[model samples]
Target: MELIYMKKFLDACHQAKRITELMPKLPERMTPRHIHVIDALFQLEQKEDSVKVSDVSGFLGVTRPSITKLLNELESLGAVEKIPDEADRRVTLIRLTEKGKKYYNFYVEEYQGWLLKQLGEADTEEFMTTVNTIARVYKIVSDQKTAPVFPGEE
Candidate 1:
């Protein structure tokens, strides 16, 4: 039973990946990872007065340097800007530019329209509930006990 379940899960993941590949291409110099960062920034913006690189890094469970590198690319693309915090000049905060907001809106509108068209209102709601259940399972598996890293192992 578990083997069958695992196979189905793996197949679903592959299908999801293929579907993403089929989605419309992003603008030049931008990729799916950039969109993920943009989405993270958008969500964090709603909850916090100011969003920091570390906050994004934590939210995405990625390294700060990775977030910084993506931010630099987005900055070059005029989608985001890094500004010094007013209260503390040493700390930097990130904010989406007008372009970023536009892109976020576009992506949301496109995805919602596509999903609704594909599944209809009732089925779309059910599909989302299933997806949310899978996400919870993933989080549980990721949080499973693991051996602690030694001081030098990393």
Candidate 2:
């Protein structure tokens, strides 16, 4: 049975994975996970005056302990700091340091430049249509799946 559509989907996935080669590499002492955390903080801070550890954990869909560990590493690198909330002395909030801001700005600029270069006069509306189609297909596929099986459950 030749699933021609599946072949195209798998090929697209391979190409998408390869697209990372065009991305700017992270600066020293920063991993992809760190970038994710910084991005979450960047977006969350836009809506909230102060972002808590739980905010990041919820944004990233990870455990609070895992977020705390990553925050500790980021803090050690001077990328983020934990400060007491002004209204509540016992509550702490997370904020990016100047270094983190630099990282975020640099990466966003670089990534945008790369994406624009790749677009190279492409039609914006058509590009968006294609992106939306892929997202809808993904949602349909995900909705068809049952609960995921864990390793030990099998």
Candidate 3:
């Protein structure tokens, strides 16, 4: 039973990966990873006054090094600006640049449109119910596991 469940989960993850791979071809300047970091920045927009590199790392459940790499990429792309904290010069605060905001909004709209088009052909009620069910199951399983139970595992 566990094996069967694992197989299905793997299949689902493969399908999701395929979709993510296609996102880069959707007339966007940023890669999917860049978009993910931008989305995290958007979520932290309300706390603009206190947004820090560590804060973003914690919020995104990623390591500081990983966030640093993403930040470096974003900085190179002129999508984010890193400023030294006034009180503590060692700490860096990150904020989205105007270009970042523009691209983020564009990607958000494009992604939304793509999702809407994909789901429009399905029965809305059933599709939403399935999505909710899957989300709940995923949350429960993810919270109970120490490691990811899906892809990237051998």
Ranking by TM-score: 1, 3, 2
Model 2 ranges with Cα > 4 A deviation? 125-153
Cα lDDT over the full model 1 = 0.86
How much is the lDDT of residue 73 in candidate 1? 99
Whole-model Cα lDDT of every candidate shown, in order: 0.86, 0.83, 0.80
Off by over 4 Å in 1: 122-129, 140-154
Model 3 misplacement above 4 A: 24-30, 121-154
Write the residue-wise lDDT of candidate 2 on 68-111 in tens digits: 99999999989899999889988789999999988878776667
TM-score, candidate 3, is 0.73
lDDT of 3 by residue, 1-154 (tens): 6799878966886797787777646333457888888889888977677688888888887899999998888988899999998999998889999988876877776775778797767897887886786777677767855655557664
> Clashes in model 2: which pairs?
none
TM-score of every prediction relative to native: 0.77, 0.69, 0.73
The 10-residue segment with the lowest total lDDT in model 1: 107-116
Best by lDDT: 1
lDDT of model number 2: 0.83
Cα lDDT tens digits for candidate 1, 1-154: 6799888987888888776666567899888788889889999999999999999999999899999999999999999999999899989999999999987877656775686688655766777887997788778778747647679977
Identify the candidate with maximal TM-score: 1
Which structure is stronger by lDDT: 2 or 3? Answer: 2
